[model samples]
Every structure is written in C-alpha cells, then in structure tokens.
Target: MVQAYILIQTDMGRAGDVSAACAEIDGVVSAEDVTGGYDVIVKVEANTVDELGKLVLAKIQKVQGIVRTQTCTVVHV
Candidate 1:
C-alpha cells in the first residue's frame, strides 16, 4: 500500500471544516487542523501511487475550502 501525508491550506476560517471533510474521504486515515504554514494535515493510504494521486487530485482537492495542497508520500528503505 502507498501512504502519504497531505498538507492543506484553506480559505480563512475554514480549516476546521476542511479537516473534517477530508477525514470523511475513503482513503483518508486522519485529518486535523494545525497551526503553521499549512492549515490541515491528513494521512491517507491507497493501493498504488497512482491511486494516491487520484485521491489527492480528484477527491481531496475538490473539498470546498481547500486553497492548495502538498502531498508527501512515504518511503520505506
């Protein structure tokens, strides 16, 4: 399985709503509002790297308040 951490930025006052909505997506393991350069951080898993991309592009990016996102895929050495 492929796993990733998605860092999200949202419109003002929408971080909580965005985090809650992301947590409801199928591939998302967890989503939380945070303070820093990004507003929300989410953990997700998928069967493949392509699937992970789709989850971020097709699903997570479509959430109402999302302004931008950065996806960090996990690597095992």
Candidate 2:
C-alpha cells in the first residue's frame, strides 16, 4: 500500500472548512487544520503511487478553498 501526507494551502480563513472536507474524502485517513506554511494536513493511502497521485489531484485538490498542495509519500525505510 502507498501512504502519503498532503500539505494543503487554502484561501485565507477557509482552513477549517477545507480540513473538514478533506476528512470526508475516500482516500483521506485523517485531516487536520494547522497553523504554519500550510493550512491543512491530510493522511491518505492507496493501492499504488499513481492511484494516490490521482486521489490528490482529482479529489482533494477539487475541494473548495484549496489553493495548492504538496504531497509527501511515506517511506518505510
């Protein structure tokens, strides 16, 4: 299984809503609103790297208030 963390940047003042929406998506295991360079952080898992990429691109990124995202795949080693 592929696992990744998605760092999201959203429109100002929309972090809470964005985080809530992210938590509802199929691949998102968890999501939280945070204070820092990014607005929200999401944990996701999929069958493959490409599938994870599509989940981020086609779903999470489509959520309202999301402005940009950075994905970091977890490395077991």
Candidate 3:
C-alpha cells in the first residue's frame, strides 16, 4: 500500500470540522487538528500512489473550509 501524510490548511475556526470530515474519508487512517503552519494532519493509505493522489484530490481537498494541502508520501529506507 501507499501511505502519506497530508498537511491541511483551513479557514479560521474550521480546523476541527475539517479534521473530522477528513477522518471519514475511505483512505484516511487518522485526521487531527494541529497547531502550526498547518491546521490539520492526516495519515492515509491506498493501494497505489495514483490512488493516493485521487483520494487527496477528489475527497480530502473537497472537504469544506479547506484552503490548501501538502501531501508527503511515506518512504521506507
């Protein structure tokens, strides 16, 4: 499986709702509101890298109040 961490930015006061919505997405393992440059951090997995991209674009990005996202694919050394 392909795994990634998605850092999300949302409009002010929307982090909690955004995180909760992301947590419900099929590929999302965990979604939490966080402090710092990003408002939410999500761990997700999919069958392939392309699938992971699709999930991020089609599902996670469409969550209400999201302003932006940065996806970091996991690497195993």
Candidate 4:
C-alpha cells in the first residue's frame, strides 16, 4: 500500500471546512486543521503510488478552499 501526507494550504478561514471535506474523500484516512505552514494535514492511503497521485490530484485538490498542496509519501527504512 502507498501512504502519503498531504499538506494543504487553504483560503483564509477555510481550514476547518477543507479538513472536513478532505476527510470525506475515499482514500483519505484522516484530515485535521493545523497551524504553521499549512492549514490542513491529510493522511491518505492507496494501493499504488499512481493511485495515490490520482487521489490527491483528482479529489483532494478539487476540494473548495484549497489553494495549494504538498504531498509527502511515507517511507520506512
């Protein structure tokens, strides 16, 4: 399985809404509003890296109030 952390930057005052919306998407494991560089931190998992990319690009990025995103794939050594 492929897991990733999506750091989302939302439009001002929309962190909670964005987080909630993200949490509803199919591949999303969790979504929470946070402080610092990003407004929302979303944890998602997919069967493959390609699927993970699609989840972020097609679903998460399409959510309203999202301004930008940074995706970090999980790696265990």
CA lDDT, every model vs. true structure: 0.96, 0.95, 0.95, 0.95
lDDT of 4 by residue, 1-77 (tens): 98999999999999999999999999999999999999999999999999999999999999999999999999961
- Which predicted model would earn the best lDDT? 1
Clashing pairs in 1: none
TM-score of model 3 (CA atoms): 0.97
**lDDT score, residue 29, model 4?**
93
TM-score of each: 0.97, 0.96, 0.97, 0.97
Candidate 2: C-alpha lDDT: 0.95
Worst 10 residues of 4 by lDDT: 68-77
* lDDT for 30 (candidate 2): 97
Count of backbone collisions in candidate 1? 0
lDDT of 3 at 59: 97
Q: In terms of lDDT, which candidate is stronger, 1 or 2? A: 1
**Candidate 1, run of 10 with poorest lDDT:** 68-77
Question: Which 10 residues in a row give candidate 3 its minimum summed lDDT?
Answer: 68-77
lDDT of 1 by residue, 19-62 (tens): 99999999999999999999999999999999999999999999
User: Model 4 lDDT vs. the true structure?
Assistant: 0.95
The list of candidate 2 runs beyond 4 A from truth reads none
lDDT of 1 at 24: 96
Which candidate, 1 or 4, has the higher lDDT? Answer: 1
Residue runs of model 3 more than 4 Å from their true location after superposition = none
